[model samples]
Target: MKKLRMICLVSTFLLGLPMLHAQKKNTQVELEVQQPATGLDKSLKRKVAIARFSNETLYGKGIFYDRDHDPMAKQALDILSNKLASTGKFILLERSDLDKILDENDNSNSRFKGTGADYIIVGSITEFGRKNIGDANLISRTKTQIAEAAVSLRLIDVSTGQIIYSEEAKGEAELKSKSTLGVGASADFDISLSDKAISAAISKLVENVINNCMDRPWRAYFLTVDDGNLFVTGGKSQGLAIGQEFIVKEKGKVVKNPQTGLNMELPGKEAGRIKITFTGGDNPESEFSIVEFIQGEIDHSKLENYYIEEIKI
Candidate 1:
């Protein structure tokens, strides 16, 4: 009877081994799926512009050949712009017309309008190359190659020209080839590997940038004011919450600096406070917020210049 029991126990253990392995494999897959998203938050949308990326790599220095013809910089810029746009968290402006705007400003055209971008994104490709990471064994010669890409990115607040966030990220892809007993297989340098590495780095960098930028308070302009009711530019799409209080302020005057010869907007004075009461629901794209005056008088004349600053606390 004891021998029979032992045999039964061994059989059960063998049967459960596959089940345990399957559970462990499933747990690993779940962990991979739980990886954080590499996109910006959808709650608040911001207007942004992506500048052409500068190539700062050694290859860009023309040591071996002229770098002007290299497409790395342009590729990086295009990829980043596409990725950011895909997130749907930003209103990307036309970068192609930027030179025209600059030329207009240089020509002393007073009517050169701004791009209205809240922030400008600039970046440079610092490192982009591939290297061999393979070794030769006695029985089998194995070779591995790694493609790497690195970039430095910065987000500048367009209104203040202040760098709100900056980050650098690096990514790599590996290819391995081995020959055992005269049978061999090898992998060559693939362009897709470099692209993938750069894309991975950009994804991580963008995630970091958005996480940092979103910590700031949201701001909007007052579209219309009717007695105690107020209509604001943003709504639920901009992360406006019910019962949120906003500080009302009058628009400031634009003054030209005598030293730098640049136009600047003076800080506005706090008028009073208002709280969001209702928000548009059907069309989120055209969403607006309705706020009731909590402790301020509506100035009909200032309606055009009035704006709301979110209370962070």
Candidate 2:
């Protein structure tokens, strides 16, 4: 009887090997490939920061879902940050120090001092959970699970305190399993559907972000002027390619708002146009490029007050 029991155990183990292998293969997660930046991508390059996402869904609040340990909001933020970095279209800033940086900037007397982020992205996870959609039978039981993820994102102009863009994206993944008699197959929740759903949502968000940035004009500042060459605040990272044209304008007058008593900038007259002659450094953080006079000449005396704006072709 012992020998017969051992034989049955060995048979069961052999029969389970194929099922295990198949399950492993099906659970293999596939990540999206990063793509190279195009001309449009370079033009829209800006300094950006991602704030920790808020959890607004009932699942995150532990209402319908029992799995309270899952950090759905944090996972969404991480995925979005990765997607934005891979695009090479934005200089990403650390979120942990964002509040401190903003505070310092606010209290500083210098206008240019402190960490500068042209835009800040804030998000909220609205839905994240799994639903069991399968049925059971007398001979065989079938189990189907569908994981869903959804996020709402807002792109805010840090300097203006305005929401430039807002979008929502959702993704879903399905997993199906079946069992006959005592032998069965099932996929883990993490690998089978949850991860895929998050990735899909991130992909959609990235597309919308890129499209919105493209609609805006590119702007930069003149860092220095020497020997008739203008050192601008942008380089290849900002899409300032060789022979690109930019309009240089002297800083305009500061006008005070009557209601708020806040200072605002008036539109400045066109100083001149400059063409990119040499691009220096590849680092996006300190990107700089040299420019030569293309149309009108810049007044060297007013170089400190000049700013540059790209002229779109």
Candidate 3:
């Protein structure tokens, strides 16, 4: 009877091996947990910058640690960046080391101009704690170490310099070790667990941030017009398919805002509509699309004053 029970357990374990392997092999693990079926349009991606991340929590401030601005803050920032990048929904700007990137861009033929961002994210590690809990009996002992973290995020519109979205999330990670007569498993301090906790916390906010940032219009700039052929700064890679039609709008008037001391652009007016006739380019930055004016008229000599926009649904 005992042998039969052992064989049954072994069979159960073998049956689950394929599922475990599949889970481990899943490439979409970096995406959000239980992601919804509906998602953003493939061609529409936003320009995002991680402006700042700070540690507001007292945790991880040891004698050797920089308590004024803890490394935990930077760690959280990196984790958040990875989560956002995984979604492939934004053109992430290197804000943490902008100067270095610019210098490198100057030295090389880099296409990145270090230009404006549609949105910027400011985040902070607000709370963190770690502790070990133990349970012991006559024949066995079990210990678990848990790391919990809370993160706050604020999405700022670079165009208006306003806080567009704000949210907070919490996450926890744990490691458990069990011993039967001190002959089983044991563990020491695991620093990587903290990172996992922070990552989990950041994951909770990524989808929301993406949705809020995408609530605005998408635009493609005019590269040039030559010999009656119009070229736009977007191509197939950006989800700009041939036969797609978009409105061309002349840029709005730039006016100084007395309240915020910022220069804001007024609403642009539709100048014409264009349909994508051809798309070429290897990547987003260098991509170009040839389009024909379907309706209305566009000024070829003053290309800077106009931009191509996706038609509103």
Candidate 4:
């Protein structure tokens, strides 16, 4: 009798454990769901441009396919552009936008080049194909529609004209349907599958894009300083906040490499430090900042000779 009683007690405890855990989980989920999303969070916004996204494969082309307006290429480009923008880490530009920015900058201030995309992503859809596979038995048949896509990408630094990152990725999508006695569902040629396949391929590379673009050190250039007021090329649109300190460094001389036939700039030494006082602009491409000297000073007359970097921890 005692053993049965003990068994009943153990079963009750075991059952009660799940109840306690469930109650705790419900409270935790409620707390998590109550948290709101704020769009004003401080996030890095680097300048990036989509140089080109070409479709090299013959998968979606026919006699009527226009080389200049390849739908496949356009689809891939749109997918990649949207994915990169969704991260909120880049100010995207097209080839046409570059000229407009340069012109506007030249008009606004000769010193500030405005915001040009330092990084450009070049991509190609290398391969794409779709097929239907069918399996049959005595009384039942099954069909599966499959799509496969492959893409190659290169992230280039516009200033250095160098490929900073390169990668290739592939994606696939499948849909299966089974019919018994010819009484099942059937699907037409779904173009959505191609979009999905391409999206999947680009999604795999977005992280690499963000990481390589950010790996390069952030640098702000001196635009102009007048009567103790200093202005830099970046503003709040590019993540500059008031009271943030940055170390200033003199511009290093550029030298041509004898072996590679390439011109490279030597590392600049620290000159001084400055703190941001104001950041204002109507748009990211026209942004500017006012700063006050905190430590050290640069040749204000030769603004092109100095640049700013984040203070080291």
Candidate 5:
């Protein structure tokens, strides 16, 4: 019985070898992710240039301002500029630095003259104030006072001198003590008038700006494949770097919709992970990588499922 089984297994293996050899190998190894190129390189990361912010003030419901002027306008600008700089996505240039560049470049174009910036955020305080209202009629017989402030911001593309984004943010301050009753004795600190309060509001606005730009058309993604010392053809220019892991996927087939009778594209399947162990230093085009590990076989028949290729910078 064992001899017959062995002979049958050998015959089966011999027959399968020839059948597998008849399958043609796919030669299109490298995949392109974007179509039409979008005028921007999909493979390169997006860079930002954050310009100085303008300050403006507006009035709203609250106890009337004292003889001293509140510095909310300036406070807002400082807070927002710092917050934007911390995001690391932007190249934040201080007003002084920009002025110096303009001096060196000696250009008269107000847009860039001295600023090598991609984006510029110009903002102004529209209103700052507190108001009190008193009711004199029998129907009301009372008065109320409220404090308020508002700011308007706009982000412009310096290259095109066009506004890319604009938004208005407002904040209000409530007075706990009436000016008539507490004159000088009232709490010396007003939350709405404090730099910290203004900074917090501006921080929220800066965060909003960041979120808005996350899915922008120019956003880029990176993936690294380093198995058996696999190297990439692109580098910093291609926006790749060390310690990056890219998810591998196999392209899927096109299926037809039963009801519509239209062909629909199928989703790709995940293959494995590729980690970069090395990078091409001092040369962006000559960049290469060494593979750290591979999760699955290199030559899977499922390569048809590959899609959504990404690399890291």
Candidate 6:
């Protein structure tokens, strides 16, 4: 009877152990989630433009057919752009706008010279292979899939016509599932496999590029308004620094894009200096900042009367 009682106690303890451990682990995870991101120091922004992916080489070997669109290259570019933008330290020009600049360059009749883009990103990809791996004990019958993607990007400085940033990355993902499971396995596994790995590599590249340009004076604007505060709604995470001062310039009349027939806005006039009191959180929509200093009294009248003139020498 004593042995049975002891056994019952031991069984109950063993069963409860997992619950205690699970609770502890969950608490730890919650604490970690609540922790703020480290490295909150000022991050500098770069004026970067990314070009579309160009296919450099194709990979396939054997009697099997290999003919399909490789979507990951462009997908990777888009993801990289978003990740870079997320850092809040970049003036990212849209890919379409960059293409427009390129188009203008290729045109002989166009009078619009390049805006002297600081850095241009060009990339190419090579798809290596696709294979499956799992429960492959049946060396011959096991359907194994392995895919490899290689990417290379160049950051060209328009001023010097030099490649300031160059990086290359390659990744392989494996899909191992029952043949009956169909194509969903490929899509699902790739997303899970690549999101973590590819994003990390590109994040490092972006950080490196920004670090290289940390000392350069990036573009910034300032303002003084009667509202007592100015919103910094859009900026690369590294674009604006805490305590950095800006000279507010009023934006002028609207302009039209001749090719796409789009309306573009320009800065009209210089107002006064405004200093950044604090930085923001991650997302642009979620960014919150305060205007700590304004030089002059600004109201709707000042805004209406503002007109920018070229700085006299």
- RMSD to the hidden true structure, all candidates: 13.1, 18.8, 14.8, 11.2, 18.6, 15.0
Q: List, residue by residue over 1-313, the lDDT tens digit for candidate 5.
A: 9999999999999999866765422222222232112122333433444443444443332477531243554566666777776765554544546424423543322535334344566666665665655534433234344555566777654533446678877766544433342232234345444454455445557766765444443311123343434443334544545555565555456666689554445665766665545556464323444444357544533332242235333
TM-score of each: 0.61, 0.66, 0.68, 0.77, 0.41, 0.44
Looking at model 4, the pairs that clash are: none
Which regions of candidate 2 fall more than 4 Å away from where they truly are? 1-44, 56-71, 100-114, 182-184, 226-229, 250-269, 297-306
Tens digit per residue, CA lDDT, model 4, 276-297: 8888889877788998887987
Candidate 3, 13-94: lDDT as tens digits = 9999999888876846745444422322445777777877888877756678774356788788888888888887777767
Best by TM-score: 4
Please report how far candidate 1 places residue 88 from its true position, in Å: 6.7
Can you tell me which runs of candidate 3 are displaced by over 4 Å?
Answer: 1-42, 51-75, 93-117, 136-140, 180-184, 253-264
* Poorest lDDT segment (10 consecutive residues) of candidate 1: 104-113
* TM-score for predicted model 1 compared with the true structure: 0.61
**Candidate 6: stretches off by over 4 Å:** 1-41, 59-70, 95-97, 100-113, 134-144, 177-204, 215-313
lDDT of each: 0.72, 0.71, 0.78, 0.79, 0.50, 0.54
Q: How far out, in Å, is residue 8 in model 4?
A: 59
TM-score of 3: 0.68
Q: Once model 6 is optimally superposed onto the true structure by TM-score, how far is the C-alpha of residue 44 displaced, in angstroms?
A: 4.4
Candidate 6 per-residue lDDT over residues 1-313, each given as its tens digit: 9999999999999999999999999999999876533322344455677755555654423356332344556566777788767867666666455555544544231222253345677766644444555553333223455656666777765533446678887766555544332423333345555544445445556666666555444443332343656554333354544555555556566667698554455555666665666666775334445554357544544543442121211
Candidate 3: clashing pairs of residues? 43-238, 43-239
Task: Mark the regions of model 1 whose C-alpha exceeds 4 Å error after superposition.
Answer: 1-42, 58-71, 78-95, 98-113, 223-231, 239-245, 250-269, 275-292, 298-306
Task: Indicate the residue-level lDDT of 36 in model 1.
Answer: 34
Error of 5 at 201 (Å): 4.8
